[model samples]
Target: MDDNQEASSTKRLWGARFKSEPSAALKALSRSEPSFFRLAPYDLAGSRAHARELQRAGVLDANELAQLLACVDEVEHAFVAGDLHPIEADEDVHTFLERVLTQRLGPIGGKLRAGRSRNDQAANDLKLYLRDKARTLATAIGDVQAALVAQAEQHIDTLSTGFTHLQPAQPIVFAHHLMAHAQAIGRNVDRLIDWDRRSARSPLGAAALAGSAICRSPELSAAELGYDASCENSIDAVAARDHVCEFLFITSMLAVELSRLSEEVVLWSSRQFQWVVLDDGYCTGSSIMPQKKNPDIAELSRGKAGRLIGNLVSMLSALKSLPLAYNRDLAEDKSAAFDSIDTLSLVLPAMAGMIRTMRVDVDQLRRHAPLGFTLATEVADWLALSGVPFSEAHEITGALVKFCEAQDIELGALTPAMLAEVDARLTPEVLKHLTLEAAIGARTGQGGTAPARVAEQIARLKAVLDKQAAWAADYRGPRC
Candidate 1:
């Protein structure tokens, strides 16, 4: 081919309607190859499906369909192997792939664009990409849940302080605290699964707002691409990005949960708490300090939550006040979604490893479980159970705590005379309930810190993880 022929072939997809080529500034400002090229495999998968639809519509013969499908397969393999890329003249994945196809099959490949537009193509590719990614994220979330369950099972009878407003409020089994994080993670998985249900619809046949007359059967393409159903409205199909917004929200919530767990790991590993020991592999050392180990993984996870949240906000802002059918502004969605996916990919594995390897200071937790007059609640409950009005019992318990604070003694140190002086109803029997063992055991209600209840909670969360594992394992789709 001559230089002029090669240059003409590299021109934009719709240049025939205009007298001149687009300005360099417009091309530079409108380029999306860097962000959307990753969707090449999905785009090829959609192309193959659309190829069959073309054959059904008589736009292509059986031989042309065969050739087109084969060429699409080649393009996909080259892309996956990193042998294909967009040139300086290509604007997006669609332009680059179409250019490659036209160069290979000449005019036969041009028939593939008969009933398709970049608007529907872009929407379809993102759905396919996120559908596959959601499965991966569910599995990753399960890995973190497995780490939490392992720690919880190992510490079922272990004692720890339960706090309200960051102040010691009661005694609880350590497993209960770990299971709290597991519960939050389980909800995240549920949200992801629910999000997939709405996102599984296909927009491929919507073709720039109105339904395609040439390829009148979108159901065939939808089924071929593993979508649950074809979209009900063509304009809504290409214009709506609420699915992306929902995805951002779901992932942002997951990041928020990881951040909360990370904060606790940071605090518990500090010298002030000394309740957790960081594994060397998961921790970082300071340059200047001779003795410093930092929970950098946890800190990074916490920081990345803000980034995920910003991605959600940015996508929402981009979608605001845009007209229907399709707009250039929708291009902003790719970067935000891709960034969230990338951030979670980096964070989930590190979080699972850090939790799985870190050592909990069981002895320290046990030693401090009964400090800060944590048993005062048991005394109040005892009085409430002994026919004393709860209001009166609360006052009496406050007085006992104040007296103990002045005397600089624990609840166990109070004598019968001192208890009587504080409350005439304070019999020797009240002392029996003050023990830490009794304090933890008394919480026998469902979802409580008692050993039996903690055991039940573990079993419940494990059942949830098992279902998520099965869902991820059983997922089947047209993946490249």
Candidate 2:
């Protein structure tokens, strides 16, 4: 069919015969062609399941089933090999695949749609597609987690300043801070895995917003397709794009987290901080300036997260006003979903590269990490232990901090005599507690930033990561 005729035919697929053509703007806005290529894998996967179901229901004899399966395989191979490109005139992947099958296998190929509607079929395809994508994304997240964990372990003994409200708060082992990020990403991976389980249902038999009258069993199709279950209701199956929304939500959250890390990279690589140095390969020089090794990749990762978040908001807005069942508005779903997936695919690997290559300047981190009287808490605790009221201890420490600031000396620089001049209760042993090592070592509580505590956390994180690796290895498509 010509492009206009093809567009008209697509409208016919809705079970209505329009007397006039669709307006050009509406046609363009409602077009599903860009999403067709992305939907092909889903179409192929669902077709495989349906072919098996047809065989089970006696709709196709064993010989005919063999021919049909072969034809499907050929189509998949051709599409993958780039010999069968999706036509712009095709309404969606479903239409394109049907057209290809009918053209290749003649009348026998037409039977593939016997008990299936685009409603259930499209839903099934999207589910299958997202299931696989989630698995792959889970792996990527795990890789990034592993990278962070490795860095944390390497820097466990490396002292750095931990900040609160953009000011140095305390001295901490750098690994302790890095491992916190690893734990956050590890949770993200778990979220994706949980979403995968929830999304692992087949919607392939909910034909045209209602259950099909055909004798075929959806359970059989679900089993063949590796879905955990068939969707319970026809209208809910076709109308529900919640799975896609959930996937996008998780991805958007992950993007936000990644952006936060990227912001740190950007700041650390700056001349003002210089605590971390990105590799020459990852760092780019400004075209106009001769002395600029810009953290462009990190900045880009941070910026791209906005796009991911925007896509999620756009999708939610699109679905908010729609009534029950499928609408042409639902065609808008793929662009947002596809954009999120594509943006994440780009971001995860780029971030992985940055993390793997970036260098942490231990000396620089140590020098500035201990600035701003970060050992003040240790001083307050010392006074509180010596029978001073906790609030009074805090005030006394603040006074000592102001005194040290006026003299251009750190709290550690104060001698026992100098400390005693400020607070008569101060002793030599109390001064020992002001040292950075003593301060950090005293905080040996569970989940503390002490070196030993960091080591313990790293060991636990390694065990969790190993279990995730095993799970990824054992995954054989979606579970039923």
Candidate 3:
């Protein structure tokens, strides 16, 4: 048959109840082929498993089931190789697959639709697709974390000014700052693993909002398709979209973490900071300005975070008011989710490359580490350790900083006479603790920015990353 004839044959799927054909406007408005066509492989996979269930229940005899399975495998191969595609009349992946199956098997192909509805089929296909994508995303996040850990190891002793309110607050090891981002990303991977466990249940047997009479064994299909179990309630199986929303939430959080790290990349690469230099391959130049080499990867990463957040909001809004069973509004979930998956797939690798290639300015970082009187806190600590009340010690440190600021000298530049003038408590011994090395070394407590502590933190982070890698590998094994 011609393309039009084949498409018209499929259009009769729901035509018996209607007196006339659906209007052109309704057809155009209801079409979801573009957003959901990518679910074709997953739909076919579910079909093969459902076919086994049908055969077990005597809905299709052994010979007919064999023919159905072979045809499904052919359609799946054609779809993957780009030899098959949905025509304009195909409303979604389900309709397109059914049309192809019918064309291959004649009347027997229609029998596969006996115990299911588009409602449960779409739900099953989406869960399978997202479960696979989640594994891929977790693996990509591990790449970014690996880049950060490698950089942190290289800068274990490099000193930089740690900031609060964008002003220097203290001296810190540069590795400590990089590892902080790595820690945040590790948490994002944890969220993905947790979400996968909760969403692994199959919705295949939950046909049309009520239990199916023809196909009695949802558990058989669930096991065949590698699900944890069949869903407990058919209505909840078809209507609930919390899994999609949760995936969006996880990706939104992942984007925000990348954006935070990207903002720092932008700031550090600027002339004012000079703390980092971007590799030429990862940066972009202006059309007219010869001196312009911008950190475009970082900038784009920051901008894409807003799109992820918007996708999460859109998914949540679409789900807030819908009643039980299935509704047409569920179609709105795919585009938002697909856009998030696509956005992250593009952004994650670019970020990993940018981070892996950048150069750090160790001299620049050291020069500014002690410039803002960052050793004032150390001096106060010394006074407190000497039996002075911390409140009084804070007052003494403030007075000393004020005196140095008026004289236009840094904390390290003060003389013994200057110490005596500020306070009798500020003896010559106080200057010993004022060095950048001493300041960084003093914070040797757990999770501190001290060199030894930062090294320990990196080792711990590496252990967690190794665990995350194993999880991703297992998740992508045979079931996926």
Backbone collisions counted per model: 0, 1, 0
Superposed Cα deviation of residue 470, candidate 1 (Å): 1.5
Task: Return the TM-score for each candidate structure.
Answer: 0.97, 0.93, 0.97
Off by over 4 Å in 1: 1-8
In terms of lDDT, the poorest run of 10 residues in model 1 is 1-10
Which 10 consecutive residues of model 3 have the lowest summed lDDT?
Answer: 1-10
C-alpha lDDT score of every prediction, in listed order: 0.90, 0.79, 0.89
Model 1 lDDT tens row, 108-181 = 87898999899999999998998888889999999999999999999999999998888998999899999999
- For model 2, the run of ten residues with the poorest summed lDDT: 2-11
| Model 2 lDDT at residue 17 | 68
For lDDT, candidate 2 versus 3, the one ahead is: 3
List, residue by residue over 271-297, the lDDT tens digit for candidate 2: 899888888888788889999898888
Scored against the true structure, residue 443 in model 2 reaches a CA lDDT of 76
Report the number of backbone clashes for model 1. Answer: 0
